[model samples]
Target: MNQHFIRNIEVKKVRHHKNFSIHIDDTYPKHVIFTGKNGSGKTSLLEGVKSFLELFDQYSIPALSEWRDMVRYNEKSLNEADPSNVYLTDQFRNQITFFSDQIDQFCKKVELDIKNAHEIHHLLEEGKFLIAYFNATRTSSMLTPNGVEKVSLTKKYPIQRGAGDVFIKYLVDLKTQAMFARQEGDLDTANRLDEWFSYIEYNLKYIFENDDLTLHFDYKNYNFLILEPNKEPYDLTRLSSGFSSIFSILAELIMRMESSRTNLYDVEGIVIIDEIEAHLHVSLQKKIFKFLTDFFPKVQFIISTHSPFVLSSVNDAIIYDLYEKESYEDFSNYSYEAIVEDFLGVDQYSSIVKDNLTEYENLINKSSSLTQEEEEKVQKISTYLDNAPDAHSNELKLKKSYIDLKRILREDTI
Candidate 1:
């Protein structure tokens, strides 16, 4: 199937990223996983990507033509934004041309002559292209517009579209209708509604690891239930935080796909999973990459994660480290711990322990005998470890090192 994915992306001067780029090719899998520290621009990259796509999808042709001149940067805002390495208002316009060219190429690749804003809008209205962006903020409340919410095709989704609630509401409505039809002895109408929803039920069930698990919506309680073959049913929250997270994510993805007149196997577009491991267990973190890929075979997945456990399934996947500005196509020989400590340059020890160990080791390597100042510092460390009611393991070890270091200053190991 003809499709589209980000072959390369460059965020020259976007939020918190002065210059960040990732080049993808057909050599690796279409799914890309980005990993970084907390303040290391992982979320910022996702924000930038979403911003660009929103621009491409929404901007008119005249707007694109005049985007560069559409903004005036105030001095105060620019100065404030400079500290965060981002823009005041001009950043979005500056990248309009780049995203325009990308969209042009993407259209050509998909065999669509969507050269201008109207053409893109028309194609999107027909559901020829779609985006399934599951933003990190998943706890957003339901939006029941105009006192009614219905399951229908939509070209775009706001960052906070909680399809999980709407999806349940749709099912509850359908079940209610089916119940009324059955009470009226209209078995055909009731059976037809079940047939219409069979595929979705199968999809929801198959995504779970346990095939015996069955999902049911409790219209009275307004919650979902998970029942197994022999065990008693329970609320989905009892499983794991990650389970409900992915369940909601998949719920939205599938709903969007079906509403677009597409399916998981053939929908062609981009998917953004911001902070993929935010609410996931370590085990679930290890499975999400493959699960997403297998579930949506034709879509390009760009997800961000902060967990090292994600390395468990980086198979044929491009791994980008935004903090280090490094990209790896393969780390098959490295353990997840090694990736965290050595490859990613994260020290396992705390700052105090590492610094004290460094000071002690420096004294050991430099001096054959202890100086007065060195002896005083060692005595201090010993006191800190002794009088402390509860001390860290490394601190206790440092206390022992102080004893031996006082005996001989020529020690270089911690």
Candidate 2:
């Protein structure tokens, strides 16, 4: 039998702090969700997982070159003939090359005796062992042996042969603009690009109208089209942000699922999604959360979100608290997914929180009669909203929803 586990995550010499760790027990669910305030190291923690995997695949060396003192350059103290003096840049470059060679030598000595059969399995458990990262920073071009070149969609490119990515460039294009154009010495490829553009222009009308999604691709090169798959193109501005965000997420999840299935029982696989609820509608948020339960049922999913709508759909999760104290002290808090599971189970509670947030939005927009006690509580929640950050609007919305639910529950007792 094959088994997979994350084991643990540890960080060092990173942006946030000197050190931090997250330990997961076997009690973790196959589908996991993580909720925390912004800047709570959620993305950083997820990056740890990706970084570790990249190390195993030898793709992370460039990013981590500084850590190993691999950068070598000239030293002014010694002459050029002797090992005395060298130019700073040359010394830095030479040291990096030496370190890389040393590390490769070390790996050869150590890797042979160990087994890594579970590496692939663990990663695929979360969908597609080949990590497909989607964030705002991804660019339109990636360096290749030939030089920087335009990326293609609809067909695979030679430069992307070793990289196991399918469709990330399309997601990036969702927020940007993409059009087919001819490149030097490649009219056929340009024509192919034109065909893809024509197809996208004709078939993706609905997505364009919604203006909520961005598409990306990882083919001959990386490209973002700022479009989604649709039957017809609509005015990009009219589409709902929530809908488009969910569309981007769902598309990626589905693609990953299909890819993961090709290899079953592999270890060292995981899917890390940052801000899983970005720019999505409330209803779509809830639906997407629920839908994810079905999409990658066996894969381990680690998603970060500030949206309560995203929280309500999770059956099990690890909640990390990033609150701080005034005396320059740092501490963190955690809650099991079970607490969230039970909290969202009440009928009034679930109904108000689970559905696409339109219902709650309508309720908030309408007036409601309240008793003295009920009125006082709603007032308190509203007041709390005054001090909350703008990024926490969803948290406030959830707070208000609970207040309304409490009011209804209290009236039932009377």
Q: Best candidate per lDDT, number?
A: 1
The runs of at least 3 residues in candidate 1 whose Cα sits more than 4 Å from the true structure, single-residue gaps closed, are 26-29, 60-121, 140-150, 159-162, 173-209, 217-224, 228-232, 235-240, 262-265, 348-414
- Candidate 2 vs. true structure, TM-score: 0.42
TM-score of each candidate structure, all chains considered together: 0.61, 0.42
Root-mean-square deviation of each candidate, in angstroms? Answer: 11.0, 14.2
- lDDT per residue for candidate 2 within 171-278, as digits (tens), equals 333212323334355566666545554444442433334454433343344333444466443322233555445444444444344333433223223456677767
In order, candidate lDDTs are 0.60, 0.43
Clashes of each: 0, 65
Off by over 4 Å in 2: 27-32, 59-118, 121-128, 136-240, 256-269, 323-414
lDDT of 1 at 62: 48
- lDDT of each residue in 212-287, candidate 1, tens digit only: 6666767666555777787778764454556667866766665556655432445655678887776887777777
